[model samples]
Target: MTIKLIAIGKTDDKELVKLIENYQKRLSHYIQFEFEIIPDLKKAKNLSESQQKQKEGDLILGKLNPSDVLILLDENGKQFDSVAFSQYLQKHMNSGIKQLVFVIGGPYGFSEDVYSRANGKLSLSKMTFSHQMIRLFAIEQLYRAFTILRNEPYHHR
Candidate 1:
Protein backbone atom coordinates (compact mmCIF):
# COMPACT_ATOMS: atom_id res chain seq x y z
CA MET A 1 0.00 0.00 0.00
CA THR A 2 1.05 3.55 -0.65
CA ILE A 3 1.30 5.96 2.30
CA LYS A 4 0.69 9.60 1.42
CA LEU A 5 1.09 12.64 3.64
CA ILE A 6 -0.71 15.81 2.63
CA ALA A 7 0.10 18.95 4.51
CA ILE A 8 -0.98 22.55 4.05
CA GLY A 9 1.72 25.05 3.03
CA LYS A 10 5.43 24.63 2.43
CA THR A 11 8.31 24.35 4.84
CA ASP A 12 10.21 27.65 4.75
CA ASP A 13 13.02 26.52 7.05
CA LYS A 14 15.79 24.97 5.01
CA GLU A 15 17.00 22.79 7.89
CA LEU A 16 13.57 21.36 8.47
CA VAL A 17 13.17 20.73 4.75
CA LYS A 18 16.48 18.85 4.72
CA LEU A 19 15.42 16.71 7.67
CA ILE A 20 12.08 15.94 6.04
CA GLU A 21 13.87 15.09 2.80
CA ASN A 22 16.23 12.73 4.62
CA TYR A 23 13.34 10.86 6.16
CA GLN A 24 11.50 10.77 2.87
CA LYS A 25 14.53 9.16 1.27
CA ARG A 26 14.76 6.66 4.11
CA LEU A 27 11.04 5.91 3.86
CA SER A 28 11.33 5.08 0.15
CA HIS A 29 13.21 1.89 1.01
CA TYR A 30 10.22 0.36 2.79
CA ILE A 31 7.05 1.41 1.02
CA GLN A 32 5.60 3.79 -1.52
CA PHE A 33 5.47 7.18 0.22
CA GLU A 34 4.25 10.46 -1.19
CA PHE A 35 4.42 13.85 0.51
CA GLU A 36 2.24 16.54 -1.03
CA ILE A 37 2.11 20.15 0.04
CA ILE A 38 -1.00 22.15 -0.62
CA PRO A 39 -0.12 25.73 -1.34
CA ASP A 40 -0.94 28.30 1.32
CA LEU A 41 -4.10 30.21 0.61
CA LYS A 42 -3.75 33.68 -0.90
CA LYS A 43 -5.23 36.64 0.96
CA ALA A 44 -5.93 34.39 3.93
CA LYS A 45 -6.40 37.47 6.11
CA ASN A 46 -9.56 38.31 4.20
CA LEU A 47 -11.26 35.04 5.09
CA SER A 48 -12.77 33.93 8.39
CA GLU A 49 -11.38 30.87 10.15
CA SER A 50 -14.29 28.78 8.94
CA GLN A 51 -13.82 29.91 5.38
CA GLN A 52 -10.12 29.15 5.43
CA LYS A 53 -10.74 25.69 6.78
CA GLN A 54 -13.43 25.12 4.18
CA LYS A 55 -11.08 26.14 1.37
CA GLU A 56 -8.27 24.02 2.74
CA GLY A 57 -10.64 21.13 3.24
CA ASP A 58 -11.76 21.34 -0.36
CA LEU A 59 -8.19 21.13 -1.60
CA ILE A 60 -7.50 18.21 0.77
CA LEU A 61 -10.58 16.34 -0.37
CA GLY A 62 -9.61 16.93 -3.97
CA LYS A 63 -6.29 15.11 -3.47
CA LEU A 64 -7.94 11.98 -2.14
CA ASN A 65 -9.09 8.99 -4.13
CA PRO A 66 -12.35 7.28 -3.26
CA SER A 67 -10.61 4.23 -1.80
CA ASP A 68 -7.97 6.11 0.13
CA VAL A 69 -8.15 5.83 3.90
CA LEU A 70 -8.12 9.35 5.32
CA ILE A 71 -6.55 9.94 8.71
CA LEU A 72 -6.25 13.38 10.24
CA LEU A 73 -3.43 14.40 12.55
CA ASP A 74 -5.56 16.14 15.09
CA GLU A 75 -4.99 17.30 18.66
CA ASN A 76 -7.99 15.36 19.96
CA GLY A 77 -7.25 12.08 18.20
CA LYS A 78 -5.91 8.86 19.67
CA GLN A 79 -2.33 8.73 20.88
CA PHE A 80 0.07 5.79 20.52
CA ASP A 81 3.53 4.91 21.59
CA SER A 82 6.21 4.02 19.05
CA VAL A 83 5.61 0.27 19.18
CA ALA A 84 1.86 0.71 18.91
CA PHE A 85 2.27 3.07 16.00
CA SER A 86 4.38 0.48 14.19
CA GLN A 87 1.59 -1.99 14.80
CA TYR A 88 -0.85 0.53 13.39
CA LEU A 89 1.20 0.76 10.23
CA GLN A 90 1.40 -3.00 10.04
CA LYS A 91 -2.34 -3.28 10.45
CA HIS A 92 -2.94 -0.96 7.54
CA MET A 93 -0.39 -2.68 5.35
CA ASN A 94 -2.07 -5.99 6.06
CA SER A 95 -5.50 -4.60 5.26
CA GLY A 96 -4.73 -4.50 1.52
CA ILE A 97 -5.73 -0.93 0.91
CA LYS A 98 -4.49 1.07 -2.08
CA GLN A 99 -3.47 4.25 -0.33
CA LEU A 100 -3.40 5.55 3.21
CA VAL A 101 -3.66 9.32 3.35
CA PHE A 102 -2.83 11.39 6.42
CA VAL A 103 -3.46 15.10 6.41
CA ILE A 104 -1.95 17.97 8.39
CA GLY A 105 -4.40 20.81 8.12
CA GLY A 106 -3.85 24.56 8.12
CA PRO A 107 -3.76 26.90 11.15
CA TYR A 108 -7.51 26.69 11.64
CA GLY A 109 -7.51 22.88 11.41
CA PHE A 110 -9.87 20.72 9.40
CA SER A 111 -13.38 21.67 8.40
CA GLU A 112 -16.52 19.73 9.33
CA ASP A 113 -16.54 18.04 5.92
CA VAL A 114 -12.93 16.94 6.26
CA TYR A 115 -13.57 15.51 9.69
CA SER A 116 -16.68 13.77 8.49
CA ARG A 117 -14.82 12.07 5.64
CA ALA A 118 -11.91 10.87 7.74
CA ASN A 119 -11.60 7.20 8.63
CA GLY A 120 -9.60 8.00 11.76
CA LYS A 121 -7.69 10.73 13.60
CA LEU A 122 -4.26 10.58 15.24
CA SER A 123 -2.45 12.87 17.63
CA LEU A 124 1.35 12.90 17.86
CA SER A 125 1.12 14.76 21.15
CA LYS A 126 -1.38 16.49 23.36
CA MET A 127 0.43 19.81 23.09
CA THR A 128 -0.01 21.83 19.93
CA PHE A 129 2.75 22.02 17.30
CA SER A 130 3.41 24.36 14.43
CA HIS A 131 2.11 23.05 11.10
CA GLN A 132 5.59 23.07 9.54
CA MET A 133 7.11 21.28 12.53
CA ILE A 134 4.37 18.68 12.47
CA ARG A 135 5.23 17.85 8.86
CA LEU A 136 8.75 16.95 9.90
CA PHE A 137 7.53 15.03 12.93
CA ALA A 138 5.03 13.04 10.92
CA ILE A 139 7.55 12.11 8.19
CA GLU A 140 10.15 11.12 10.78
CA GLN A 141 7.65 8.99 12.61
CA LEU A 142 6.61 7.29 9.43
CA TYR A 143 10.23 6.47 8.61
CA ARG A 144 10.75 5.25 12.18
CA ALA A 145 7.67 3.07 11.98
CA PHE A 146 8.91 1.34 8.86
CA THR A 147 12.34 0.78 10.35
CA ILE A 148 10.80 -0.73 13.45
CA LEU A 149 8.69 -3.01 11.31
CA ARG A 150 11.84 -4.21 9.56
CA ASN A 151 13.68 -4.83 12.85
CA GLU A 152 16.25 -2.20 11.99
CA PRO A 153 18.62 -0.54 14.50
CA TYR A 154 17.17 2.92 13.89
CA HIS A 155 14.74 2.65 16.78
CA HIS A 156 15.89 1.70 20.30
CA ARG A 157 13.65 0.29 22.96
Candidate 2:
Protein backbone atom coordinates (compact mmCIF):
# COMPACT_ATOMS: atom_id res chain seq x y z
CA MET A 1 0.00 0.00 0.00
CA THR A 2 1.12 3.54 -0.63
CA ILE A 3 1.47 5.81 2.43
CA LYS A 4 0.96 9.55 2.17
CA LEU A 5 1.37 12.26 4.79
CA ILE A 6 -0.54 15.48 4.23
CA ALA A 7 0.16 18.39 6.50
CA ILE A 8 -0.73 22.07 6.55
CA GLY A 9 2.09 24.53 5.86
CA LYS A 10 5.75 24.01 5.03
CA THR A 11 8.38 23.37 7.64
CA ASP A 12 10.29 26.56 8.43
CA ASP A 13 12.97 24.84 10.52
CA LYS A 14 15.70 23.50 8.29
CA GLU A 15 16.90 20.91 10.77
CA LEU A 16 13.42 19.47 11.28
CA VAL A 17 12.75 19.43 7.55
CA LYS A 18 16.01 17.55 6.98
CA LEU A 19 15.10 14.96 9.59
CA ILE A 20 11.61 14.58 8.15
CA GLU A 21 13.11 14.13 4.70
CA ASN A 22 15.58 11.56 6.00
CA TYR A 23 12.81 9.37 7.38
CA GLN A 24 10.73 9.86 4.25
CA LYS A 25 13.68 8.72 2.13
CA ARG A 26 14.11 5.65 4.32
CA LEU A 27 10.39 4.88 3.94
CA SER A 28 10.79 4.70 0.14
CA HIS A 29 12.96 1.59 0.53
CA TYR A 30 9.96 -0.43 1.74
CA ILE A 31 6.93 1.30 0.29
CA GLN A 32 5.66 4.06 -1.92
CA PHE A 33 5.73 6.99 0.49
CA GLU A 34 5.12 10.66 -0.14
CA PHE A 35 4.75 13.82 1.94
CA GLU A 36 2.54 16.55 0.54
CA ILE A 37 2.36 19.97 2.14
CA ILE A 38 -0.76 22.12 1.95
CA PRO A 39 0.27 25.75 1.92
CA ASP A 40 -0.93 27.93 4.78
CA LEU A 41 -3.96 30.10 4.21
CA LYS A 42 -3.48 33.73 3.25
CA LYS A 43 -4.95 36.61 5.31
CA ALA A 44 -5.49 34.35 8.30
CA LYS A 45 -5.46 37.35 10.58
CA ASN A 46 -8.78 38.61 9.28
CA LEU A 47 -10.39 35.17 9.52
CA SER A 48 -11.97 33.73 12.63
CA GLU A 49 -10.60 30.43 14.01
CA SER A 50 -13.50 28.51 12.56
CA GLN A 51 -13.14 30.26 9.22
CA GLN A 52 -9.46 29.47 9.05
CA LYS A 53 -10.10 25.82 9.89
CA GLN A 54 -12.87 25.55 7.31
CA LYS A 55 -10.59 26.94 4.62
CA GLU A 56 -7.76 24.66 5.65
CA GLY A 57 -10.19 21.75 5.79
CA ASP A 58 -11.24 22.43 2.24
CA LEU A 59 -7.64 22.21 1.12
CA ILE A 60 -7.13 19.06 3.19
CA LEU A 61 -10.22 17.35 1.87
CA GLY A 62 -9.38 18.35 -1.69
CA LYS A 63 -6.27 16.16 -1.56
CA LEU A 64 -8.16 13.03 -0.56
CA ASN A 65 -9.55 10.36 -2.84
CA PRO A 66 -12.58 8.19 -2.04
CA SER A 67 -10.59 5.00 -1.73
CA ASP A 68 -7.89 6.45 0.47
CA VAL A 69 -8.00 5.58 4.17
CA LEU A 70 -7.90 8.85 6.11
CA ILE A 71 -6.20 8.97 9.48
CA LEU A 72 -5.82 12.13 11.48
CA LEU A 73 -3.01 12.77 13.94
CA ASP A 74 -5.02 14.14 16.83
CA GLU A 75 -4.43 14.58 20.54
CA ASN A 76 -7.57 12.69 21.59
CA GLY A 77 -6.98 9.81 19.19
CA LYS A 78 -5.89 6.30 19.97
CA GLN A 79 -2.33 5.84 21.14
CA PHE A 80 -0.31 2.80 20.13
CA ASP A 81 3.03 1.49 21.18
CA SER A 82 5.72 0.93 18.56
CA VAL A 83 4.94 -2.77 18.18
CA ALA A 84 1.22 -2.18 17.98
CA PHE A 85 1.71 0.51 15.39
CA SER A 86 3.76 -1.84 13.22
CA GLN A 87 0.95 -4.33 13.44
CA TYR A 88 -1.56 -1.60 12.63
CA LEU A 89 0.33 -0.76 9.46
CA GLN A 90 0.69 -4.44 8.62
CA LYS A 91 -3.03 -4.93 8.97
CA HIS A 92 -3.76 -2.15 6.54
CA MET A 93 -1.24 -3.44 4.00
CA ASN A 94 -2.63 -6.92 4.28
CA SER A 95 -6.13 -5.54 3.90
CA GLY A 96 -5.10 -4.17 0.49
CA ILE A 97 -5.71 -0.51 1.20
CA LYS A 98 -4.62 1.45 -1.87
CA GLN A 99 -3.41 4.46 0.01
CA LEU A 100 -3.09 5.24 3.70
CA VAL A 101 -3.32 8.96 4.37
CA PHE A 102 -2.42 10.65 7.65
CA VAL A 103 -3.01 14.34 8.21
CA ILE A 104 -1.54 16.92 10.55
CA GLY A 105 -3.84 19.88 10.66
CA GLY A 106 -3.13 23.62 10.99
CA PRO A 107 -2.21 25.51 14.19
CA TYR A 108 -5.73 25.88 15.54
CA GLY A 109 -6.69 22.26 14.73
CA PHE A 110 -9.07 20.54 12.33
CA SER A 111 -12.49 21.51 11.17
CA GLU A 112 -15.55 19.50 12.17
CA ASP A 113 -15.84 18.35 8.58
CA VAL A 114 -12.26 17.17 8.56
CA TYR A 115 -12.73 15.18 11.76
CA SER A 116 -15.89 13.56 10.49
CA ARG A 117 -14.24 12.48 7.24
CA ALA A 118 -11.45 10.55 8.92
CA ASN A 119 -11.65 6.76 9.20
CA GLY A 120 -9.36 6.73 12.19
CA LYS A 121 -7.18 8.95 14.39
CA LEU A 122 -3.83 8.35 16.04
CA SER A 123 -2.10 10.21 18.82
CA LEU A 124 1.68 10.16 18.98
CA SER A 125 1.77 11.38 22.57
CA LYS A 126 -0.27 13.22 25.15
CA MET A 127 2.21 16.08 25.16
CA THR A 128 1.61 18.90 22.72
CA PHE A 129 4.02 19.38 19.82
CA SER A 130 4.43 21.91 17.06
CA HIS A 131 2.65 20.95 13.85
CA GLN A 132 6.02 20.95 12.00
CA MET A 133 7.63 18.74 14.62
CA ILE A 134 4.70 16.33 14.47
CA ARG A 135 5.34 15.86 10.76
CA LEU A 136 8.87 14.72 11.48
CA PHE A 137 7.71 12.51 14.33
CA ALA A 138 5.07 10.83 12.23
CA ILE A 139 7.54 10.15 9.43
CA GLU A 140 10.12 8.80 11.84
CA GLN A 141 7.50 6.59 13.51
CA LEU A 142 6.50 5.29 10.10
CA TYR A 143 10.13 4.47 9.37
CA ARG A 144 10.48 2.73 12.70
CA ALA A 145 7.25 0.79 12.19
CA PHE A 146 8.50 -0.60 8.88
CA THR A 147 11.78 -1.57 10.45
CA ILE A 148 9.95 -3.37 13.21
CA LEU A 149 7.83 -5.18 10.67
CA ARG A 150 10.93 -6.41 8.86
CA ASN A 151 12.72 -7.35 12.07
CA GLU A 152 15.38 -4.74 11.40
CA PRO A 153 17.50 -3.44 14.27
CA TYR A 154 16.58 0.18 13.61
CA HIS A 155 13.89 0.06 16.29
CA HIS A 156 15.21 -1.01 19.68
CA ARG A 157 13.08 -2.43 22.44
Candidate 3:
Protein backbone atom coordinates (compact mmCIF):
# COMPACT_ATOMS: atom_id res chain seq x y z
CA MET A 1 0.00 0.00 0.00
CA THR A 2 1.04 3.56 -0.65
CA ILE A 3 1.09 6.07 2.21
CA LYS A 4 0.46 9.68 1.21
CA LEU A 5 0.63 12.82 3.35
CA ILE A 6 -1.25 15.91 2.13
CA ALA A 7 -0.80 19.19 3.92
CA ILE A 8 -1.58 22.81 3.13
CA GLY A 9 1.21 25.34 2.58
CA LYS A 10 4.95 24.96 2.07
CA THR A 11 7.61 24.71 4.74
CA ASP A 12 9.79 27.83 4.76
CA ASP A 13 12.19 26.80 7.52
CA LYS A 14 15.25 25.16 6.00
CA GLU A 15 15.91 22.95 9.03
CA LEU A 16 12.39 21.58 9.08
CA VAL A 17 12.48 20.92 5.34
CA LYS A 18 15.74 18.98 5.68
CA LEU A 19 14.42 16.88 8.56
CA ILE A 20 11.19 16.11 6.76
CA GLU A 21 13.07 15.18 3.62
CA ASN A 22 15.38 12.88 5.58
CA TYR A 23 12.45 10.86 6.87
CA GLN A 24 10.84 10.85 3.43
CA LYS A 25 13.96 9.31 1.96
CA ARG A 26 14.09 6.67 4.70
CA LEU A 27 10.41 5.82 4.09
CA SER A 28 11.18 4.87 0.48
CA HIS A 29 13.04 1.75 1.70
CA TYR A 30 9.83 0.34 3.21
CA ILE A 31 6.85 1.70 1.25
CA GLN A 32 5.70 4.06 -1.43
CA PHE A 33 5.41 7.40 0.39
CA GLU A 34 4.21 10.63 -1.17
CA PHE A 35 4.26 14.06 0.44
CA GLU A 36 2.03 16.59 -1.29
CA ILE A 37 1.69 20.25 -0.38
CA ILE A 38 -1.24 22.39 -1.45
CA PRO A 39 -0.33 26.03 -1.83
CA ASP A 40 -1.85 28.39 0.72
CA LEU A 41 -4.96 30.22 -0.36
CA LYS A 42 -4.52 33.68 -1.88
CA LYS A 43 -6.19 36.64 -0.18
CA ALA A 44 -6.86 34.47 2.83
CA LYS A 45 -7.06 37.58 4.98
CA ASN A 46 -10.18 38.62 3.13
CA LEU A 47 -12.02 35.34 3.72
CA SER A 48 -13.79 34.13 6.82
CA GLU A 49 -12.52 31.05 8.64
CA SER A 50 -15.33 28.95 7.24
CA GLN A 51 -14.72 30.19 3.71
CA GLN A 52 -11.05 29.36 3.92
CA LYS A 53 -11.75 25.90 5.25
CA GLN A 54 -14.28 25.30 2.50
CA LYS A 55 -11.80 26.32 -0.18
CA GLU A 56 -8.96 24.29 1.33
CA GLY A 57 -11.26 21.32 1.76
CA ASP A 58 -12.12 21.39 -1.93
CA LEU A 59 -8.46 21.21 -2.87
CA ILE A 60 -7.81 18.46 -0.31
CA LEU A 61 -10.69 16.37 -1.55
CA GLY A 62 -9.63 16.87 -5.15
CA LYS A 63 -6.30 15.08 -4.50
CA LEU A 64 -7.86 11.79 -3.51
CA ASN A 65 -8.56 8.72 -5.59
CA PRO A 66 -11.86 6.87 -5.20
CA SER A 67 -10.18 4.00 -3.38
CA ASP A 68 -8.05 6.05 -1.00
CA VAL A 69 -8.70 5.82 2.71
CA LEU A 70 -8.69 9.31 4.20
CA ILE A 71 -7.37 9.98 7.69
CA LEU A 72 -7.33 13.43 9.20
CA LEU A 73 -4.68 14.61 11.67
CA ASP A 74 -7.14 16.21 14.03
CA GLU A 75 -6.60 17.52 17.53
CA ASN A 76 -9.48 15.50 18.95
CA GLY A 77 -8.63 12.28 17.20
CA LYS A 78 -7.35 8.94 18.47
CA GLN A 79 -3.87 8.76 19.96
CA PHE A 80 -1.63 5.72 19.81
CA ASP A 81 1.78 4.76 21.11
CA SER A 82 4.62 4.01 18.72
CA VAL A 83 4.17 0.24 18.86
CA ALA A 84 0.43 0.54 18.51
CA PHE A 85 0.76 2.83 15.55
CA SER A 86 2.95 0.30 13.84
CA GLN A 87 0.29 -2.30 14.44
CA TYR A 88 -2.33 0.06 13.09
CA LEU A 89 -0.33 0.46 9.90
CA GLN A 90 0.12 -3.30 9.69
CA LYS A 91 -3.62 -3.74 9.98
CA HIS A 92 -4.21 -1.46 7.00
CA MET A 93 -1.56 -3.21 4.94
CA ASN A 94 -3.11 -6.57 5.76
CA SER A 95 -6.51 -5.26 4.68
CA GLY A 96 -5.13 -4.71 1.17
CA ILE A 97 -5.97 -1.07 0.65
CA LYS A 98 -4.52 0.84 -2.28
CA GLN A 99 -3.61 4.13 -0.66
CA LEU A 100 -3.70 5.51 2.88
CA VAL A 101 -4.04 9.29 2.84
CA PHE A 102 -3.44 11.45 5.91
CA VAL A 103 -4.20 15.15 5.76
CA ILE A 104 -3.01 18.09 7.88
CA GLY A 105 -5.49 20.87 7.29
CA GLY A 106 -5.03 24.64 7.22
CA PRO A 107 -5.16 27.02 10.18
CA TYR A 108 -8.94 26.76 10.46
CA GLY A 109 -8.82 22.95 10.26
CA PHE A 110 -10.98 20.72 8.10
CA SER A 111 -14.38 21.57 6.65
CA GLU A 112 -17.62 19.70 7.31
CA ASP A 113 -17.36 18.01 3.94
CA VAL A 114 -13.81 16.90 4.65
CA TYR A 115 -14.81 15.46 8.01
CA SER A 116 -17.62 13.52 6.43
CA ARG A 117 -15.29 11.94 3.90
CA ALA A 118 -12.61 10.81 6.38
CA ASN A 119 -12.22 7.14 7.27
CA GLY A 120 -10.51 7.97 10.57
CA LYS A 121 -8.77 10.71 12.55
CA LEU A 122 -5.46 10.56 14.42
CA SER A 123 -3.79 12.98 16.78
CA LEU A 124 -0.04 13.14 17.34
CA SER A 125 -0.45 15.00 20.60
CA LYS A 126 -3.01 16.74 22.76
CA MET A 127 -1.17 20.07 22.50
CA THR A 128 -1.32 22.01 19.24
CA PHE A 129 1.64 22.20 16.87
CA SER A 130 2.53 24.40 13.93
CA HIS A 131 1.63 22.98 10.52
CA GLN A 132 5.28 22.83 9.41
CA MET A 133 6.42 21.04 12.57
CA ILE A 134 3.55 18.60 12.41
CA ARG A 135 4.59 17.66 8.89
CA LEU A 136 8.00 16.61 10.19
CA PHE A 137 6.55 14.84 13.23
CA ALA A 138 4.10 12.90 11.10
CA ILE A 139 6.76 11.83 8.63
CA GLU A 140 9.18 10.83 11.37
CA GLN A 141 6.49 8.84 13.15
CA LEU A 142 5.76 6.98 9.95
CA TYR A 143 9.44 6.18 9.61
CA ARG A 144 9.66 5.10 13.23
CA ALA A 145 6.59 2.92 12.84
CA PHE A 146 8.17 1.09 9.93
CA THR A 147 11.36 0.61 11.89
CA ILE A 148 9.46 -0.81 14.83
CA LEU A 149 7.73 -3.22 12.53
CA ARG A 150 11.10 -4.43 11.28
CA ASN A 151 12.58 -4.89 14.77
CA GLU A 152 15.12 -2.17 14.06
CA PRO A 153 17.13 -0.34 16.73
CA TYR A 154 15.85 3.07 15.64
CA HIS A 155 12.64 2.76 17.60
CA HIS A 156 14.42 2.16 20.91
CA ARG A 157 17.29 4.49 20.09
Which candidate wins on lDDT? 3
Segments of candidate 3 deviating more than 4 angstroms:
none
Worst ten in a row by lDDT for model 3? 148-157
Q: What TM-score number comes out for model 1?
A: 0.98
Alpha-carbon deviation at 136 in model 2, angstroms? 0.7
Give me the displacement of residue 11 in model 2, in angstroms: 0.3
- Model 2: how far is 80 from its true place, Å? 0.4
TM-score of each: 0.98, 0.98, 0.99
How much lDDT does candidate 1 score?
A: 0.96
Which pairs of residues clash in candidate 3, taking residues 3 or more apart in a chain or in different chains?
Answer: none
lDDT of 2 by residue, 1-157 (tens): 8999999999999999889888989999999998999998989999999999999999999999999999999999999999999999999999998999999999888999999899999999999999989999999999999999999999985
lDDT of 1 by residue, 1-157 (tens): 9999999999999999999999999899999999999999999999999999999999999999999999999999999998899999999999999999999999999999999999999999999999999998999999889889999999984
Full-model lDDT for every candidate:
0.96, 0.95, 0.98
TM-score of 2: 0.98
lDDT of 3 by residue, 1-157 (tens): 9999999999999999999999999999999999999999999999999999999999999999989999999999999999999999999999999999999999999999999999999999999999999999999999999999999999987
Report the Cα lDDT for residue 104, model 3.
100
